[model samples]
Target: MWRIVAAVVGLYRMVMDATRELFIRILMGILIFLGYVLLSLFIYAIMRRIMVPQKLHTLPVHLQYTPGCSDIQCPFPQAELILNGGKKLLSSGQYYKILLELEIPETNANQEVGVFMVNLTFHSTDGRYLSSSARPVMIRFKSFLLQILYTLFFAVPLLLGLWEQKQVIELVLFESYYEPYGDGALSALVTVQHHGVQLYSTQLSIEANFSGFTYYLYQWPISMSVIVIISIFVSLCTCTVLMWVSDVVRDYDEQRRAALQRRRMIQARTTGQAAQNGLGTQRRGRGRQQVGSNTALPPALEETTGSEISSEETSTVTGVEDLASEMGRGQSTPPPSITPTEGSVTSSDYSAGFNDVLSSLHTLSRELDGQEVGVANRNIRYRTGH
Candidate 1:
């Protein structure tokens, strides 16, 4: 019975361990999925809120039903028209050919919807003359999954591109450019005619930016001024950022070159000192053997040299002590080593040399005494001979 109870308890513990691990794995997977989903949602919300509205405002209003609207006399509800709004002439017993364009938003119906009757007419101020003319048009918008994706995809870029859409309208004014009386402003007459009837005729006055003049259309100033301001701001910001980046790169390059020069100087000094001490160590044979047997110098050299050292010779020098221990003691010393003869040093050497040079340069930082370093009268104590 004791044996049976022990086996059952062991099986229960195994099952509990497996269950706990599975639960933890599942939780981790869920968190990763949620992280990606939330990020996508945040991007979508930002584009929809700030970008879409701006694009809609600047989108060109294409007059879909304008050119062939002469035969369209049937009344179509929910149809509207937009014009230059600066015309002023009308005559009796004449019809104006008007163009109308319509845009339909997305609908749930699977089949395409067709356009109905559309027309345009102008009423004179005398309440006696009225002219009307129009044409039949068919406009249809397609629906697909890709269309929805495209709308989302282009929504943000389009918004940013059109964010400063100050040049929203490019009107071809008919003879609407002239300066009058050498004084106030420029004035000209413009006319719009349809079906042999004048729908709009007006005299427009244009004011210059610097001159003391006022004109017919106020919309011109709003659009042009806003666009100019935004363009200037964007240009200034771009130039500023470029200047800042260039300055940073220049400063960084200067510091790097200075550091390199300092490193080379310190390395030359160290090499001179090492050579002068009669300790011109080589990487082989009898001398290494004696040194290894007496001290742990070989491994320490390997560690220090390996941190910044390169080349086959450097590595061999590092392994010299280890090799010496392998050899029998009391062997004769090896030949002298030489510096590298050719090719530029590696980036690794620069990094290594940086550390060594920095340490040496800052050595005086730890000094507690206030003695002048280079004074002729000072007791310039030298370090002990290596």
Candidate 2:
């Protein structure tokens, strides 16, 4: 009986430990998914910043009239051109396409054509202009490769640390079944004794102590390490896949909602007169409320409620009527009158009373048996003899 009790307690502890681990893993998975999403968004933003086009400052055009095309001779023709939003600031070491448009009025179309040479100039924010020969030149900035390399270097350690922490958690929960050896060394250490000669013996360093505690570290077996690595990779992959599935499901749900909305809109449009009369609106509102109420419960709660209903149904099967019947016919009938025998009853009479009590309790508990009935008979006979 004690062994059974101990086993039950141990099983309960294991269940609690497993439950705790499951919750932790679930929370970690959520956090990992969120981190992955944030990282993806950050990378996308960076790529967008790198790839977006940057516009340069516009160049002013100077028109030089020919000798016969003075204001009085040609009345300098009027022209109009519309340009879109102005130039954007450009980063150094970037290449951009340059476009120049010239519009000449029809009135000067027959005028003497002169070779028009225009000089472009670029001015820095510090009031320094580029030399004439350097017009249309490319600007150079520091290379981004070094920055990327440094980022990767930092990220690798951070990722490794996270992986290590995950492995430590797994070790604490699952891989800690084996106790340390007599000398506090892990099981990986091996020792052999042959004829009082110690052979092939290895021990951990014994000098490491901090704050009254000694710390011993050992390398995990290759198989265990590989398993841990694979498990971590698989878990991360699963989380990513789940994230993608959730996104897809969300999008599908949105589409479904949109389709439903469109259908409702179309229905309302088709029944515009009815809707204006207020009957259709009231019907639709009632339907929506019913649907919302039906869907409001979470899936977990739904399952729990379903289980509870099933349990209640099962429990209702053993009703009070059935229990009263099982208690014994004596419960509903009067007890038989016992005749006096020499001013005393035999042991059999006492045993019969004990059996009746046992039977009643057995019916109530549904677990008592003949073994307890025999034990009660023996006790009653022993008392009667004494």
Candidate 3:
């Protein structure tokens, strides 16, 4: 089972690898095709430079001057010698047909004419059917140079755009974080048009439009470093404050726990001491009981005076009552109360003693309640059962 699983995994990996390779190859092929197209265009441009002349031949300058002529003159001569019997008259100005031959190697000085009226005609060398014209006007050699320069300038960026299209695509895909922009072919042509005037009713041949997207990237190390530094500083400060708070809270909790533990220990010790004292009292009581049992006392030879007996009884009861009062008020456990026997104190005396003890306990409870109220007013915290 393990072997089969391993084989399947290996096959999957191989397939994925092959697919990735194919994708990469496709991208590279696109790049190669783009390069080839650019190279071809560049070569074609170079060949055109060699094969086509920098200046085109000046077409034959055909013109007719009416007898009376002015810059704005339009002479209506009578038609006399017409081929179809339409009368015509000789109405002309100084007629000089200067064919502005835009010769390469060297330009003739007369090739430059200014402000003279001129007509244009496009025809074949065989003198076959073509356009006829009888108007003369200004011409300038600089116009030709201007046109050539403009055309060349426009052509450059266009070819460059074509050449770099693949690279541009790749850059856009992979380095999307960078901004890319260019005018491409259209921008080149617009730049060319800006250079010269069109005389022959120009028709633009190429149409190119390019669009690009912009992206942001870190340019300055200082700015990036500053942001990072600020972030780290803020984090460090935040962490420090948190840690300080934690430490303070931890210390406070520990101290509170320790205080509570100490209080409990003291309570425990006091309880144990109270238990021991109670045991000692019990032992003493047992001894006293033994002594009483062993000796037989003679019957009272003479009755004691009523006042003396009363006073004696009163003193004993008072002592017992004082002991009970102390036990009740102390908050800690006290020795158990000893009940007087039939021969001892009366019931009325015992009741009075118990009333005194209860009174004392009520007073202590009031005092504790007052202390609790005071603590609330002061916002003071103290352990209970202290």
Candidate 4:
């Protein structure tokens, strides 16, 4: 029983983990789908909004049956539209064409549409006459739906490729450049004319598209100022962010360079200071070595120095006594000189030669000691043995 329970628990856990993973995957897929759908809808809406051209339209007006409209007679049910309103503009700087649509929605049966005529007149913002276009819409078929479909497919393309629109859009009233900044008004007129004797007297029996068929005009859509402003704003923002980033990078580089330079300076100063300390320690050690060994001379040099000192002492004593005696007796005598010896050193042989000066001082002292002194005295001198 325990084994069965464990197996069931394991199975349950496994199933739960799989279910959780599946749920997560499903949720992610759903989110992605929703995001894609939303983006598509947004793009579609914007495209539709941008693709709608500046248009001039009016409420459909019934064209009263008559002998028909002629240029010599007044056209019936003229449609007028304002260019400055929320509707599509009727301004200049673009090509324009007029199309007439006839409909017989009240009729249950289909009837043939005969020849018709359309007139489009555009006026400037000051109500001044600008341009006019008149064309007899002579083409017709048994099927009104087919006619609408054909025009929808090829109307705008035909207008774009043809330069005949320029013939009607002559005279400048905000011309030379295209901008969504002008205002104007235009009128659409349509006339239903019979073709080669009216076969069917029932005009309402014709099946046609019932919408504003007579007022439709074609014009190319243009982008508004809002899109341009948004683009400029985005560009300025990007440039500002880039400039700020450049400044930050430059400042960082400068600070890093300064830190490296300071570090190098510190290293150089420490190195020089260490070198000076090393030299000072070496000089001090050398000075100590000189001090320690200076007093103890070699055996031969010690004996020589001692003999030189003893010989000088003896000479000084003898010289002083003789000088004293000579002065007392009113006679002068020369000072004694060092005899040549193997171990003795002479004044001329060494750097330290103080014996002569000491002897002179001694002689002077004896003369000053209340003795009549005569001036015939010489300094004791030393001679080294060859």
In order of appearance, the predictions have TM-scores of 0.19, 0.26, 0.24, 0.32
Q: In order, how many clashes per candidate? A: 14, 0, 21, 1
Which portions of model 1 miss their true places by more than 4 Å? 1-219, 279-386
Candidates' C-alpha lDDT? 0.37, 0.37, 0.37, 0.43
Deviation (Å) of 107 in candidate 4: 17
Give the distance in Å from residue 70's predicted Cα in candidate 3 to where it truly belongs.
62
The C-alpha stretches of model 2 lying farther than 4 A from their native spots are 1-6, 50-88, 108-110, 131-386
Root-mean-square deviation of Cα positions for candidate 3 versus the true structure, in angstroms: 25.6
Tens-digit lDDT track of model 3 for 21-62: 999999996986566556555554454333322221122212
lDDT of 1 by residue, 1-386 (tens): 99999999999999999999999999986985566556545554553333222111111222222444544362222222222235322111212222222333334321233433334443333332233444443333445775677668778876788432111112322122222221311111122222212111112212222212122112355564445445554555567689999999999999999999999999999976865432222212112323223221211221122132335433453344334343324253322232434664344553344334233223322221222221112121211111
* Candidate 4, pairs of clashing residues: 101-213
lDDT per residue, candidate 4, 1-386, as tens digits? 99999999999999999999999999996986566556555654554444434343324435444355434355343445444546544333333433334333212222333334445455655676755555453323335686567557778775797422111111111122232245544332333333222222111110112113111311211343335334544555567689999999999999999999999999999987876665455435323322223221111111111122345645654665665455456473323455647666553542122333334334445542432111111223333222
Question: TM-score: which is higher, 3 or 4?
Answer: 4
Highest-scoring model, TM-score: 4
- How far is 373's C-alpha from truth in model 1 (Å)? 32
Clashing pairs in 2: none
